[model samples]
Target: MPATPAQPSFALPVPVATTVAPPDLTDSTLLDVDPDAQMSLGAVALDSRSDVVYATVELPDGARRELRLDALRPTGDERLPLVVFLPGGAFLRCNKAMALEARRHVAESGFVVASVEYRVTPDGATFHDSVRDVRAALAYLRSYADDFGIDAGAVALWGESAGGHVAALTGVTDGLPEFSDAAVLQGQVRAVIDAYGSSELSAIADDFDEAARLHYRHRATQFSAYLGRPGAPFPEIPDAVRAADPAAYATASVPPFLFLHGSEDMLVSPSQTQHVHQALRAAGADSTRYVLKGANHGDVGFLGHPGTGLPWTSAAAMGVITGFLHRRLDATER
Candidate 1:
């Protein structure tokens, strides 16, 4: 007889009791629900076959946003690990197109993948809104873990560019009272993937100035807007800029991090990733940095496009991600 493969073990998620039903996406009224409504907390709409759910997440101040989560467990496994992906668009908006990457990750890694929508700075928002939104989504996922068959204890945060900064902030600042939400989360992030995210705002300020002198700069870049003053440089807004810089907040308690960047990334310099990685290691946190040679910002090469024929591939990047998560999250499961 052929040998049977060993089954993966997962910690059973705590069941949630609620009378709140899945909201109708078309109803604008459901757009903003009360977070205090226990029955409606983390309310979401779902597709049974795909195991994908769209959660109507309520912010601390009662504003609302929708979060998409795709549950992709291997056949016969009752539950699987979770990986939350934050999309990059500077801080202006969360790109909707990243859903394709989410699906690809599910197919390749068999992990529950979540793509979050955070309020961008262009909507009169700031770094606070983005960070709070990501935290709220994290709480919602854990609060309703049973409904999604997610291993609440095994979770990772992955992001690119601005999204990467948000993920880094959320993970590095875990357990701070101000950052917590209504959902009583029981676990911590096991790993983080930061792909070419700006680690320091001061560096961005310099980048903006150089772009301006070259006559190729937009009147208001995302970083300036995120500082609450569009077209202003970081030197003029030192305090808020410092508050939003992930490198400034790096601590020993941060979860293991994998930093990826293209050596030639002109938008968010590869140096930003390198600096943060150094900070993490200095704080005694586990970290790794990989630079894709001659890759530009947001290019296909960063995602490991084989057609680009770059020396580095997205396959290589994804491989490092899964390997890190497996080592971190799977080890915890065992």
Candidate 2:
């Protein structure tokens, strides 16, 4: 199908993410090149004359990666709040597009948002690499905040599914150089919104039935694709899975949280939200959890349908997310 407009479905442009070979090349057996250089992302960058556009940065690894945000102005005339967005695709599929459009949606409510592209398990990537890229995206956003119409110190984390897992971890465990390097994340994020993502893997619904066990085992493969050896023996699965969890960093210093999940979500159970909510509460971090009725893992929005076909916007959905942003970024007015 052709690309659909940004709404309802929330599908971002998947750029043919591959590296183009330089015109000048040696004739020795066609030359050896990195395969990540051949990854196709199908990323489309567009600007509606709103501050800035998408751009790529050469990481310390010399790989050209993508980051999207608006242009920041030096004048104190327009200091907009910002949110760092992480896209969902089981940590291997999606990119900055879904988060970019979502940012623009909330930006209409007055905030500058940034979309990040992290390393995934597509071909050559590791779990640590994903965390590293997220931290790098945070640092890069801060470095250019003045140029992107953003307030460097007032950024919230917004994400979905696996993306939410990272954002939640990033929000809660700021200042930890191990998972992330954003020193500003310590006290900056007033709130966070996680959409249908895993909050605690340990709380997965009653792992007794064979089907249930296999379902989780399959999900583990996604992480294994990046964090574990494809051919590794089964004995290493437990350690590998534990190492990738975001729950390990849950603490009182983490920011408040807003979790939205469908009661019927098959991928990640609603209990995951409950588990995280419980942790944050014990830690004394402000939190809210909303369970949508009759919804599934697809789109937690209460539009009565999963995609663009839904007639109207879900007020609960928009209200919860925006209210969180306003409270955190704009401080509730007394």
Candidate 3:
């Protein structure tokens, strides 16, 4: 196996002492890496964009399942930082194309990005099953690092909504054997970025407004559906639900977290992230929260509006994420 190149550390782009700031993120010191830098896995171009790879794992029932990961290989040297992204769909389904597009910015910024297609509830799966798959995905990526040119140790997780919940849960419970399948290594997630993820499954249903309840009256609520309990009230939260709550596992040893939630989010509620952030802080762990004003659940606005030239641009978010990864995963100091 090729030795993993030492990840470089740079000061976080945030200005600590500034009388006046640069006009845009372009002027920040963090913009050192040209986002358009060329880096690709050492294979003939699979397609126009990504290559799909399957990672197989054995379930507790002795059944085998294949988890799919769509890889966005980089264009630079071998052994780049790896980022595993899980998509949002209330844990019921995932839109592969949408998820890949959402994380495209990360991959384009000189990292090997893998969009995970973990088991979901509609397949008779539960949080436990999804978590095992998440672990398997990480282990599979690391085990095949040489083949894919990824740095095994410098890995991060990013997810949105339901995917965000799993990402946060996995981050907090990194080394716990319970979360890992026998065939998979315990997850060593070094950093986490959760966008509008639900941590406390029991309370998420209540976050729905009267209009939302009316709209989903015929369908099972997200919490109830995921828990496999129709008509279950918040007061009757099951032990399984509590066990799945990422906040329950928060500790100082967990990796640094960057949470982004829309202030106006009705579904899942911004408080879900706020609670997790509070728990992380209370545990003395590194945490950062960015609340988007006037943004709602799954809003593209959170990714930044290019036409408006806003301060909270996608360029800015990438800087924050890349900077955080450098600080947490890199060995050298700025």
Report lDDT per candidate.
0.60, 0.56, 0.65
Per-candidate clashes come to 3, 20, 7
TM-score, model 3 to reference = 0.74
C-alpha root-mean-square deviation, candidate 1: 16.0
Candidate 2 displacement at residue 99 in angstroms: 5.5
RMSD of each: 16.0, 14.5, 10.9
Best by lDDT: 3
Q: Candidate 2 lDDT, tens digit per residue, 177-245?
A: 666544534455656878767654433433133455444444445545655455442245666656656
Model 3: per-residue Cα lDDT at residue 54:
60
The segments of candidate 2 whose C-alpha lies over 4 angstroms from its true place after superposition are 1-77, 99-101, 181-188, 201-210, 218-220, 229-236, 300-313, 331-334
| Global Cα lDDT for candidate 2 | 0.56
Ten-residue stretch with the least lDDT total in model 3: 12-21
Evaluated with TM-score, which candidate comes out highest?
3
